[model samples]
Target: MYVRSQSDDIYGDVWTEEKAYCVEVEVHRVQDAEDLLFSPWREVSWTEKKREELRENLTLYKPSFEALSKVRVLLLGPVGAGKSSFINSIRSVLYRRVSLLPIIGSVSEGFTKKLKCYDIRAEKGGQPTALTLCDAMGFGDSEGTGMTLHDTLAVIKGHVPEGHKFQSEASINFNTPGYRQSPAMEDTVHCAVFVLDACKVLSYSENLEKKLKKLHRMISDLGIPHVVLLTHVDQVCHAVQEDVQYVYTSRIVQERMQKAAELVGLPLSFVYPIKNYASEVSVNCNTDILLLSAVNQILQAIDDASEDYPSAPQEAETKR
Candidate 1:
């Protein structure tokens, strides 16, 4: 008992009961598409000037504590969440070129297997910046895959040595080769970033959700500042795909970002949407600006956490 509208002619008069229902749903969806493009939920400057400001800020950033020469940041997330790609994007923005120092894997595979830290430089062959990005294997939903909980904790504590390959069944311990029994303060992670796929936020499996929650609790106990980088935003909303600046305004993207925050047990402000350079031939200003903004926020978070440390020269000098 269905009456066809003028738009229903697109089906070519061969509509069955199921087809009729689908067509009706499609009609309503198309009619309401405009509603999904909400007003600017978050304000972000999408201009070249803002881009320059962010870039310069990151380039000139220095740790508040003089004892530490560089601030270490650890990237953590589920498999194929663009952790390596995000690093490359940051490097590209800082270096002003398409830099691919970190090896990237397919959407379902993890390419980074070892615990390695990368020193970012503002220019090629120039002095490294004050920021060090540490890359590690992605976390898996199952017990015997990806990185183990112990290994993650060890890395945060600065005990795991560089170039240490992650083991599926075991974690690096005191007897492990090249392990740092007493790591310096500068070696420890000042910030932890959890990169997640925007499209998969709502679709995460039960096991994956449980794993993330557990990790969140452990990281929280350490009192380290953490944030979530919601990646692959372009794939989630059409408006964002057409224009990267439309990320915060798109209702779908905002909702997904909120869900991502809840998934990681962090505040909405801590969840940032980023689009890594996946298949681009060259860098774009909009993309660079977003990446720089995320890095700027991370540095701010690191500074906020450093405020609690003792200011005495003895403790600072010894820790360094």
Candidate 2:
């Protein structure tokens, strides 16, 4: 929308030089897709009643996989993209209190260094629920940093045992003491969640994008379901910052959703824009609804994938 002018040195001499016209930059404007809208910046359709219903549904549900005991979801993203924060946010909602189980802090060189897994339980000191989240080291711009392909495959195939420390210098081998030689269906990852910051959706570095695309192809070849979580929506959009419910209606969020979908080669429906509990002391209904909704969809994907798993029986239903 604006023009920039500059001059280049024609006759160059340190003391005296003549300038010539250089290239002018202009017409570089970014615009959101034009879509007809009836409402102007209002709360999302998800109401308090709906939030309560979803909370109850999520808390009481159990996986129907007769063979597998829990559905495993993998979390992957770059440094400081809020992967650990997302898990903590989900725990806060399910526990109905402030839970900081996963230690989250500033990403100087990626906070997590080992493979970790958490069991989502119904209540405090109760049995584990259907969902299980596994987190790994964050990816970095430079090579030989973060997780390598070998390590990623190890986790996806369920060979990399929980609490396996990631070594940037070398990948884990079968001879490693704690490596799981034979991983069961329950141990393998069922759904892959690519967590990304909404503020950087359109500005991801080239190196990061290449790594993501490479991982995407490997995940697709396995026929595993993929979902994208666009976090930190409040930082990008002002309206969403004021009220979490306005995320759906904000143009900025919608654009980020579209961009994230294209970046990860997923459909719009699979891309979820959510706000994690960054500094909140208590649980918010709207935030809980958004986070729980994403988890609900992931559980559904796990259920769908379980139908074709060889270990599962034909009647993969929980006998109440």
Candidate 3:
């Protein structure tokens, strides 16, 4: 039998007994595993000052061209992907309170049924910012379950109007009520955001995959810039759940973000991992920072896409 003790060679073997046997053992420090970090895969400032800076930037933002009044962003995704919740979160951050203007679903399906447009403000009763978030019915994984492709395309083309309830079995056309036969440049979507649950990125169904692929192609053909938001990121990594500041330092979260980017066929830079204000009663500095960062990137993308925005009917006629 041999005994172990603290020594200069903690990793050295212990020798004992008449047979002169040596048992090799290695010592490991607890701090070694605790100190393991991914070297901050992404850089983000988690301070109230940064949050206010982002808020000011968004408040002062405007469309690149004069024809457009506001940057219209369309939110699209599968059921329970937090599309509505994301809108509410943004409002909550901007208002510095818990805003639930958009209905969030509690079940496995989407809660938003109509094409609704939300005008955000930097403060309550303040002037509307130069941005609008349009929410639509989530895409389902089965036939005739969620928003139809035709309706989605029509919405992108600026044909559908606000408050138009989506019919999974029917597609929007010129004959539809309140259809904008000639939608202005400000009515169309400048950017398309595809929200996905970070935890379910790998388990997407075949039907959902096909629908996403088709939507991606269609949106690309329309020349509208698209991005993917991987929500519920706190649920994906324990480290991030404990402290959102560790989002970039957690390897698990980074891997999930990479997988989400791959699933949506977008570049790594085009994908953002966000934690919606779920179960939280008040605003959080870190959460607000992450959400604002995503919004800032989205607005930047919209400005980039605005360079190629289709000319308005009047502008086209005038130019000709």
The lDDT of model 3 is 0.83
* lDDT of every predicted structure (CA atoms): 0.83, 0.78, 0.83
Clashes of each: 0, 0, 0
Residues 1-320, model 1: lDDT tens digits: 35443435446545444334333343334632663654687788989999999988988899887767788999998888999898889888877888866477775658889998989888878888899999999988775678987898889878888999998876788889989888877767888999999988988877777777788887766767889999999998887787789887778888899999899888899999999998886889999988998999999998887776664222343464
TM-score of each: 0.85, 0.82, 0.86
Instruction: Report the lDDT tens digits of candidate 3 across residue range 49-115.
Output: 9999998889998877777788889998988899989989998998899886647777766788899
- Each prediction's RMSD over C-alphas, in Å, is 7.8, 12.9, 5.6
Worst 10 residues of 2 by lDDT: 311-320
lDDT of 2 by residue, 1-320 (tens): 33333454854452233443436634553332233134644344478887878777777767767766667888998888899998888888878886877468785788988889988777666777778888899887755778886788678877888888898787889887688877767778878899998988888888778888788887776767779999999898766787777788778788888888888878888888888998889988889888888888888877787666556221221111
Q: CA shift at 312, candidate 1, in angstroms?
A: 12
Which 10-residue span in candidate 1 carries the lowest summed lDDT?
19-28
Least accurate stretch of 10 residues (summed lDDT) in model 3? 13-22
